[model samples]
Target chain A: MNPLRWLVGRFPTLALARRNLSRATLRSALAITAVVIGVVAIGAIGTGGEAFKQDQLEAYEGFGGTATVEPDVQFEDGNLTNTELSDGDIDRIRQAAGSATVLPVHEPAGSFVQTQSGTLLFRARVKGLENPGEFYEARNGTMPDNWRRTIVIGARIADQNDLEPGDRLRVNVTDEFDRSFEIAAVLKPQGFSAPLGADRTVFVPASEFESGGYEQAIVRVDTTTGSVDAATQAIEREFNAREQLVRVEQVQEQREQFTEFFGTVNQFLIGVGAISLLVAAVTIANTMLMAAIERESEIGVLRAYGYPKRAVVSLLVAESTILGVVGAAIGAPLALGIGMAINQLLLGDPFAFTAAGLRYVGIGVGFGVVTALVAGLYPAWKAANKRPVEALD
Target chain B: MAPEPNEDDGRWQEAGDHATSETIPTDAIIRGTDVVKEYETGGQIVRALKGVDFGIAPADFVAVVGPSGSGKSTLLNLLGLLDVATSGDVRLRGRDVSTFTDRERTRKRKETIGFVFQSFYLIPTLTALENVEMPRMLDRTPTKTRQRARQLLERVGLGDRLDHYPDELSGGQKQRVAIARSLINDPDIVLADEPTGNLDRDTGDRILELFDELRRDENVAVVTVTHDDYVAEAADRVVTLIDGRIRETESRRANFEEGPDP
Candidate 1:
């Protein structure tokens, strides 16, 4: 006897079994729909949450470096600028750690820039003076040479004060010093910077900062030289013996935190999906149970013809698996569509739906088949055990 | 042990030379020695068959007749291997079949026995040809079960009704399909539990005639359970059962086409 032929021979009975299940079409459809909803929900929520978190991380990447170094131990509200690395300390760190580039920065005193229309208060963060674009580029004009009393205003600040690329403005430095500066350019608003408030800030050269001002040192490590972790550990060991407040940020730390946060949020989505899948499992089980009971006579007839008990069970399981496969096949794309729709509506960005969701769909279908098989166990056994005479009667 | 033949009984000893090659030599086509069957209902145990002894030879058409509660149906189920005897042994073709499991019984039944239920238990969803092919499906017999089923239907005078479902067919047609199904496996014994019980008188007589033709021409053993004497008279031998015991056994040569036998 051909194994293939045997399987084919049994195919008709399976088809008949599916037809028997269709007698209760509404109940079976409800079970399939439950599976569909679970898969779709998981896909949409899980993918959407991941995209949102990535956007959040990307917005913060403009913080000048892959990692930052600060005082390892500092009391809250204490002045970090006084204890952190200064210009000379930054030069030493850069020379000491050959592979890393450290940029020293300071926050100058807050002052008001007055335009023809109004006056707006803006705090200035100072970085190394260079071909100023090397420090922080502007949207319109070039950086001024020789500290020609030129300033690059923020877009919001420029809008508020009606400042332009060639306009001259008065920069009053805590009233101790005052200077008139040319507005070299306007910078696009970088979302929330830690030291500077939202849009109420500006950037200037570091050479102008006086003594006893607050400042920070940002380090960018080259990953090709060595492990970020090894570099951080070496830096900590070198700085540990000194009185200086020296802290380091390993780029790996940020990546790890990103993964941890994403994992936690994805777990939550999976939990929600699992609960719905469990409900789908129950629905599948209930549907199979009802079908098994309703077709008791039909099952008995098959058994009388010498069909094995295993075959009866297989038929029921196969029908449920087919339904689940069909549902998941349709639901997967629906889930992607839902994710795209949500991304566009909520974040103003279209997201990608990956094929990784196939793993989840396969799990859902497998669960449906096993649940149906388990549910039909007792009924299938009863049908197989029925005495032919009793069944006929 | 073979029991001595009673006087005046056609023992097959003197007429042994009449045995044709087509006739199955059933020294014990169906043999039950002191068989017993008990049924428990509502906490009361009722004995349905009580220490009964009987054997049906191959090519012999026999009838078991009794009142409704006299265990005729129970005896039919036992012979068909659909039910087990509580005590004693049943040997089919000299093999002790009493100890067989349900699966084994199904196998043996498919190999050598067939059944026709009084209710015409054709699968309601299947057409007449499909219904007839159902029994043959058990053996995986090649050569197109569907075509053989069609031939069976044609033989039963329902060639045009092959596609009709059980519900669509008349009562007579359904019984004919049931008869066709019983012959599909070409079993040695056809155990029919009141084949004509649900039909009108004329149809019932026609079905009996069909049974007679199958027994004489195909050389198949037939055990029919019926409550009507007219139906019993159509058989070559009749055994009367009362309260689950064999009360009497009688032999009559059925001159069926000519007239009723004495």
Candidate 2:
């Protein structure tokens, strides 16, 4: 015997319920299809959200241990006092941020850069850092340990000007400083989530500028050891001990904000999906009611043959539950297939799945069955409780 | 097993084994004492049965016969424990049925009485064998129920039609299936309402013969509420009702040991 038949045969109520559902194949199939659509809606959206989140988190990998500290402009008597972080502040930050690398930054006033060939002049960001090797990787040449008159330009800026190492470019800072410097290296392009717009910035030696105070400071640490968190807390404490002196923000916080925002969106979408499922529940209830009404005389005969009201109720509920189970069984896999396709298209890995994805699918299936049970209850009770004579007549 | 009495004697008698003993037998499977059944239709009290006395013993073939608007179906419902009497008590196996709780009454009805209706009432989704096994499905083991259902169908001479759906079977075959279903639980009494009313004369006669065989062989009391004169005449006793009261009770047999074979 088929396992389902064997199982149904083992229980009379299940056998009867199955037989009743099979009597109207189209209505049952339509009811089940409604449930399937509802399940797929919830599962696929949740799965797609998780995949997008995973993709973002992966993009944020390289910037995990980095944080930025800038002067928190203090407004007293309607005047800005603390506009930039001073050297004393940098020393205090280094002292507080234990075991984390700190680099003070300078912004030079350079309008545009003309290549050594003098072919074209384009605007570019001018950043002065003491050691470019600590923060950036060289794609074409090398970043030196000892910094002098050498410069590193972002790959985009180098490509735009057709510049390479050993080539010299003039910095248009002021009329007094019109000297050209040798190109040390061309820096690789930073990822989308990388801070500082590193892909388009021009890097020069900090010693070349007579800096009094810096605009920003970069803090780098090993994130796995809780060093990033420790450094952020220490820097915040040191700068804002009495009053706000500087603002400290970690790159991971932005990623977390994105995650939280998507979490809310996912829940809202699931709620919408749940509403569709409830609609399916209503359809299931109607189908069950129709079945009960159509089989009123049959139910009367069962009752007259000594079947209790509870037996009749259970039989009807069992049929509705069967409809839900079968629908969810099909819908879960279909949702999984869609999710995998989405993951493969978006993240290039079909198997890139998360617990949340599975959980959503599980929840969809669970709700499908629960809605069916809830839907069946009213019709089952009404049908079973009808007077035998009334039903028979 | 007790030997079946000779069933060929024709005599003017008072139905069942109690007639020879001169009083209603205390061992009667079911009894009604002035059972009065009423219905309130549109604020008017419509009495379906008015203080009628009736009883049936084991192995008795009793037919309730009456004209339309007489209380035959109402009394049948009360006797079958399918409904309650308005003012009197209907007893099952000498116990007052009104005193039993709802569940207990249902259980008693299930275990003690079988029913065969005019339309056969077979579930269309179920095969003939499944319909036969329906009553015993809950209380009996599946294997035991199936085995007995098979035996009953074979006894009813529809052994080859077990797997057929109700629609697939003819009117006579469906009635046979219903008869087999009625015996599946081995109830003490089988109450049939218009059992042969839907069948042709030839098929109805065969159904009557099947009822006779069931009553004699199974030792079950058969009470049939019907309008067919042939059914009334074939029964061992006939209870005729008029205007919600029992007008007369006629017997065709003196006791269980004497009756005519089909």
Candidate 3:
């Protein structure tokens, strides 16, 4: 018979498979649970990884422009000792990338501020910028108009220190210098960005940087002039001519690197999950073989009743496929639940349902069913190849 | 008896008062000629059936009796199309089935023959009605098969136990379900291989009576392989086999009128 007609003729076999699998509920359940674990692993990891990548991309995009020029720091045993960027380096970068906006920043290391009541002291990251308005918006007060002993704290730091506009805060720089600065403003909260510490940062005027020159320069490329890559290359060339040790990092490049790294990690996780599925496949095959052995007499009886070899094979394959489908039906939703749980508990974001994640669910299910079918092939063949007389005997 | 017919040419006519006319009838359900079956085990060739010639007509209840190794089951398997002979031809309705392909043999088996095993091989998971409907379902007959299955179960006095699985049924009830399943497709021949081997004497007798009724009512050829003398005594004809060859054939004038000699 043709394949379509053959499939149509297998209704009774499918029904018989259902009955048989139900009869051995514990064994079948264990097999299905194995499939469920494999599917959930693949799906949960896939969705979680994609959601994290998306979050990273959004955070990078929120940091303003794509490119940044920073000093190549000298590290001794993985601890940063000093930076090499100077004001001359920033000027040369601005000259070479004429169409780009350069915002010079001075970051004082190991600095903190205290509330006027002396109730709290936070170890803070002090960001001294020439144009702070370009990066932060006011949450409670206006930005400082004069370069003096005035400060703007991030929303979280402001809330923690209980200092709003016009509040005097004692600033301790490097555990030695102590100065009192008026809280000029509080900036709105921006989530984690690698280039800028937004939520916990304390911003001050660049003129207050008493120790050194600019530490880093943020370069915003005018898209109408050239591509971001072109501007980055121009700035890198200018820095390269001035100093041997300089690192020009772009937000887009960092995003791509993060994506590539996570993609590899996701692939490794999927491979591990596939190993579990391989174990599941072996379990299914072993179970089917045992079942075929136990049901030899029944198979003989069926053959005596004129069920062809193909029908017998179809019945077995249908049974395993049903197990796979049922397991996937349970596991797919379980994976989504796991993804959501990870989002809520670990990443602290709502569950993201991307098209790629949904497609991975589909892949997971298809993998399960196809694994079952492939694993069932040998057992089905063994069942079908039994001679009726011998099996009856 | 008359020298085993040369070709099983489908021209044999019953010679009793049940014969309606002098002309031959085309109802020669099973015909085996010079059938030989061999088995090889542990580097030894054991001949199961040497050269057996057998045939059964419609409405005939023939009992095959033999010792343990007399190849009675082998002959039954050959006639039922469950196994092919190593040599010779077994025909169904005058067609040589030895040359049939696997698909053709399966088709013919489903349409023409039914088998009843000693163990009452009912699928343990299925209800009695479902077991009986197995053959019809295998044939892919869509509708009316279930009704026919129910009717057959009722005919076998299992109407009330139709919904019960094999485990829920008694030994006799399971056997009755098997018999009902055998007749669900209305096959031309019913091959019973020691159908009462596992039953008690009274239950065996009742099963024999049921077989007799089926033979009389449906005009089906019932060929049973049995060691029980009572079963042999109840048949219209008895064929005795010894060491893979038939030794004697006895025709009884009255069915079950004279039981086996004590």
| Best candidate, lDDT | 2
**Fnat: each model in turn:** 0.21, 0.55, 0.66
Q: If the candidates were sorted by their lDDT against the true structure, best first, what order would they fall in?
A: 2, 3, 1
* TM per prediction: 0.69, 0.77, 0.78
Rank candidates, TM-score, best first.
Answer: 3, 2, 1
Which scores higher on DockQ, 2 or 3?
2
* Residue range B1-262, candidate 2, lDDT tens digits: 2222333211112244444432344557777788888898899999989888877877778889989889887876777677888888677755788888767767777777888887888999889998999987776377777888999999989989889999999988998898888877677788898988889999988888888787667777788989899888888788899999888888777554576546
For residue B47, give model 1's deviation from the true position in Å. Answer: 1.4
The ten-residue window of minimal lDDT in model 3 chain A covers A1-10
lDDT of 1 by residue, A229-331 (tens): 5556666666766665576775446655766777787787777876876777677767766766666665655555445565666667666666666567666
Which parts of model 3 are misplaced by more than 4 Å? A1-10, A70-83, A92-193, A196-216, A220-247, A343-351, B1-27, B254-262
Clashing residue pairs in candidate 3, if any?
none
Docking class of 1: incorrect
Which residue pairs collide in model 2, if any? Answer: B7-B259
Top-DockQ structure, candidate number:
2
Chain A only TM-scores, each candidate in turn: 0.58, 0.67, 0.71
Q: Mind sharing the TM-score for model 3?
A: 0.78
What is the descending DockQ order?
2, 3, 1
- Report the Cα lDDT for residue A57, model 2: 78
| Candidate 3: clashing residue pairs, number | 0
